[model samples]
Target: MKLRFLPLVAVLLAGHATAQEAVFQTKSLTPEAALKAAQAALESCRKQGYQIAVAVTDRTGLLQVLLRDRFAGAHTVTVATDKAWTAASFKTSTLEFGKDTQAGKSMSGIRQVPRVVAAGGGLPIEAGGTLVGAIGISGGPGGEADEACAKAGIKAIADALEL
Candidate 1:
């Protein structure tokens, strides 16, 4: 009887240890959310009389969605995507990153990295203190205007972000 009880307890312990429950989870931006962000950004820029392109990238710098307004510059697409990638990959706004990169010799070499656009149009997307993605805009008269447009994009989805 004792031996049989020991085997049963061991089996129960093994089953508990082998349970496949997840201890941690990660959040990401959905396609619909990305689309909304891009559209809002484009509209915001249009209101300011600027033809613009917007790009949304996931936390790892993967392009999730892109939108370009009519008459937006041909180069704006690549510029927007690179800016979004830079913000998402680095977990910082491109505007602040540019300033930091240019301020010192030690970090200045970061500008040479491929696909790293240190401009003001890129902004990180965060939800519940976790970075979910980034948005970037281009084709505005200046980076400041581009940044404002990008901010509008993020603002459109602020309620759904659970922030």
Candidate 2:
């Protein structure tokens, strides 16, 4: 009787193992690509006469690159990194997130989350219809300028990320 049950259990376990995937694949930006994006953002801000700091993060919100202009403020580092992390983690542009979470809005409480920056400088990096990473820029005149620089950064790496 016990032998009969053991075979059943074995079959059940084997079926379960074949039914679920043991591992899944995910895409992320390479370190070199992240550096290129950061450099492009910094250059874009510089062209606009705005000293800034740029940060890039992988899909998992892990920092991949960070670049700061000589005249950028010290605080820009933390702000840039937070912006990148927020964009990647939230899977949305920080500017949109900010508007959605503004005071008196239903998502206002999200503003209180640690490392969650809802500024315009952060943008998600998507390729092949998948989010690959994020970029953030800080130390510009305002969120708009920072966002513009971040856009330039994405544009610079657009072709390579087409895959």
Candidate 3:
């Protein structure tokens, strides 16, 4: 009778373990995760001795995470978020859009896109070959400075499990 119970317990434990391993959960980007990503970007900017505003947004062009350092200008948060929105909406880097917008506008049959920040520091976050979101940074020495921070943040958060 004891041997029989032992076999049953072992089988039950094995089944429980198998059930736990079968979950196979996958990670997705969320607002909190976006905030972590923004923090990473902000840290990069700090290393460069630049105070900046960082923004992260979901695929729907909504701001998910936003940050502005103590020395960052008040308005930079909005600007950076707007840039992130533009990047997510347009599904392209703000830098490319900024430069090409003029040429696109200059050419016929191309109209300027509204609310698009062509400046640097805006990048689209892609996951599973899909546009998951975007990150934007501003209030640095220049657009380039802002962009560098944002890029670092995006890369850092790309593979992280979202909470």
Off by over 4 Å in 3: 1-28, 103-114, 161-163
Q: Note each model's CA RMSD in angstroms.
A: 2.9, 3.9, 8.5
Per-residue lDDT over 1-163 for candidate 3, one digit per residue giving the tens place of the 0 to 100 score: 7887998999999999999998965433687778889999999999999888888888878887778899998889888998898888888888777777665366322324556677887888888767888899898887778878888897787666333
Q: How many Å off is the CA of 143 in candidate 3?
A: 2.0
Global fold similarity of model 2 (TM-score): 0.88
Best first by lDDT, ranked:
2, 1, 3
Model 2, residue pairs in steric clash: none
Where is model 1 more than 4 Å wrong at Cα?
A: 1-24
The estimated TM-scores of all candidates read 0.86, 0.88, 0.74
Cα lDDT of all candidates, in order? 0.92, 0.93, 0.81
Q: On TM-score, who's better, 1 or 3?
A: 1
The candidate maximizing TM-score is: 2
RMSD, candidate 1, Å = 2.9
